[model samples]
Target: MDSVSEAQFELDQLRHQARKQLLGTVVLGVMAGLLAFVGQSALGQARPLLESSFGTWQSLYTVVLWALAIAWLVALIQQALHYQNISEQFESRRRLDAVYAERAAKAQAVEEERQRQRAESEARQAAERNRRLNKNSHSTKFDFWQE
Candidate 1:
């Protein structure tokens, strides 16, 4: 509705988004680690099975291992980049929140000053009215005696 509420709502949304991004990054990292471990285990088990054949099979097995290693490296790099992006997003949100807080504080201070000035103006007006009333009443009393 108002600017303050709107700012607060936006800040909340940013926080939610940042949390979600963090969770996603963690999940990605875990998945990458699992993939590497599983791939390594599978290759280790397969090596003995092909050992009897040797020669050509050994070359193929080496190629397969290298490919898997490369894939794992790529996955790790991708996850790291995703995490970096998320970190940047968090930083941006933090800066935005700081700006919002500063603006809110300034707005509150301005509103308080405005209220104080208004109260002082009202007090001055009330005092002026009372002074005029007293002067008129004293003059009227003298007039009553003359009549």
Candidate 2:
């Protein structure tokens, strides 16, 4: 349709994308928290095992815990970066929305001014026509007073 309609549609799409990104960020944060809790529990359990006998199973358990911690850290970093990206997208959308709003307002103002000018021109034409009719009728011979 028009530019304003297109801009509004695009803005709506951006809003939807922003919402999905926010949801993804939240999911990542939750995953990171879960991983952290699991890692903490593993570490707490490992303390007792370490105090007892230092076995192969204990070594493998520690390695697994380290991997979980690493995964948690990666998830946290990803969430932070995703959040930053979302913020930038929202800012860009906001600017674009403002521009579209201004453009729509300007277009509306221009249309109103054009309509006002048209009305004024029609009024002037009608007034001129009425004046001509009045002048001709007054000069007509059919008017007994004039004769």
Candidate 3:
């Protein structure tokens, strides 16, 4: 492959890895959030309508909810960094795969060339042997038996 194609392939590999990782994180986070919305302790969600909501310790719960939002943001950033790392690894793998393919193709071409030359040489040698045999027989075939 040319340099341009190689570069494009590498770029694609990186993007694909990053996208996949991000997608996985988003799915998990949303699922967890859903669990919390249903009052699951680990999955507790912020009350949808906190505005003017009257209850004891309401301010405390609101603060806790905001803190959770901040934590989620941090988690997202961390996941992004992790996915970037994964992308780098995937890009390296793609490059290695390309190199291996190139080497294999070159080896196959060399073998084919060798096979072609060998066939041509064998054809030439057989033709020469037939020519010599015919030449000898043409001058030595006049013997008859007498009783």
Candidate 4:
């Protein structure tokens, strides 16, 4: 379509993309939290079963838990960074949209002012024409009366 419509479409797309990114970041964060919780719960439950098998399984379990915790922390940090990036993008888009809206408002105001001036000019012209017509008619009537 027109440039205005295209710009609007692009703005809408940006908004949608930002929203999706935010949602994905939230989902990732939630998943990471859930994973940590579940891991802890499972480890606690399995501790009883491993009591008899102690040493070997205990070391393995500790290593595994530490690895998972490290991984979860990393993932959480990554997701937080991604969310911040999305927020920055969203803010940028909003600023752009605000600029566009301000420009549009100024353009509309200029157009309206021009239209008002044009209408006033036309009215003045019409009034001047009417005055001239009245003067001519009065002159003709006076000449006829003198005859």
Top candidate (lDDT): 4
Full ranking by TM-score: 1, 4, 2, 3
Clashing pairs for model 3 are: 36-43, 36-44
TM-score of 1: 0.65
Residue 133, candidate 1: how far off, in angstroms? 1.1
TM-score of each: 0.65, 0.60, 0.54, 0.64
> Which stretches of model 1 miss by more than 4 angstroms?
1-52, 140-142, 145-147
Which residue ranges in model 2 land beyond 4 Å of their true spot? 1-58, 140-147
Candidate number that wins on lDDT, 1 or 2: 2
Instruction: In candidate 4, list every pair of residues with a backbone clash.
Output: none
The residue-by-residue lDDT of candidate 4 on 21-139, one tens digit each, is 65776676677668767866776788778777756775776687678668766766766676566666656766777788899899999999999999999999999999999877775
Q: Compared with the true structure, what per-residue lDDT tens digits does model 3 show for residues 3-61?
A: 64676677777677777767877786787567545543422333444434534345565
CA shift at 91, candidate 2, in angstroms? 2.4
Clashes of each: 0, 0, 2, 0
| lDDT for residue 108 in candidate 1, whole number 0-100 | 100
Better of 1 and 3 by lDDT: 1
**Model 4 root mean square deviation, Cα atoms:** 5.0
lDDT of each: 0.71, 0.72, 0.70, 0.73
- How do the residues 94-133 of candidate 1 rate in per-residue lDDT, one tens digit apiece? 6777888899899999999999999999999999999999
* Model 3 worst lDDT window (10 residues): 39-48
Q: What local lDDT does model 4 show for residue 55?
A: 61
